[model samples]
Target: MNAKELHDKTPDQLREELASLKKESFNLRFQQATGQLENAAKIRAARRNAARVKTVLNQKAAAAATDAE
Candidate 1:
């Protein structure tokens, strides 16, 4: 997923997506530790996706705070 797609989602939705991405990242790590991981690229993709979600969430929070002020 990209920032543009995440930007359209509400904070709650973005939070949910972030949760799922984190779960996937954990699973990928576990597979790697067990030497069962077939594709290492997934780990990088998951990390980047999680970061993108976080960035969007932070941006939303900052915007809300600014509006409140």
Candidate 2:
């Protein structure tokens, strides 16, 4: 779940990872609302991970655009 790991993945793989992270975040929120979540920090972690995936994806797209020029 580190930037280096994400940086090496293909865009499609990154998208999949982002999707799973978002799903996890949603489930975490649901658990918190029901007062069943053991660790609230997990929600924050998931959110940050999703952001990292998005950042990497954007960087890849930008790089591709630059290379195309």
Residues 1-69, candidate 1: write the lDDT tens digits.
Answer: 778999999999999999999999999999999999999999999999999999999999999999999
**Model 1 per-residue lDDT at 38:** 100
After superposing candidate 2, which stretches have Cα over 4 Å from the reference? Answer: none
Q: lDDT per prediction?
A: 0.97, 0.98
Query: Residue 14: error of model 2 in Å?
Result: 0.2
Model 2: per-residue lDDT, tens digit, 1-69?
A: 799999999999999999999999999999999999999999999999999999999999999999999
Q: Determine the C-alpha RMSD for candidate 1 after optimal superposition of all C-alphas.
A: 0.5
TM-score of each: 0.97, 0.99
User: Which one is best on lDDT?
Assistant: 2
State each model's C-alpha RMSD to the native.
0.5, 0.3
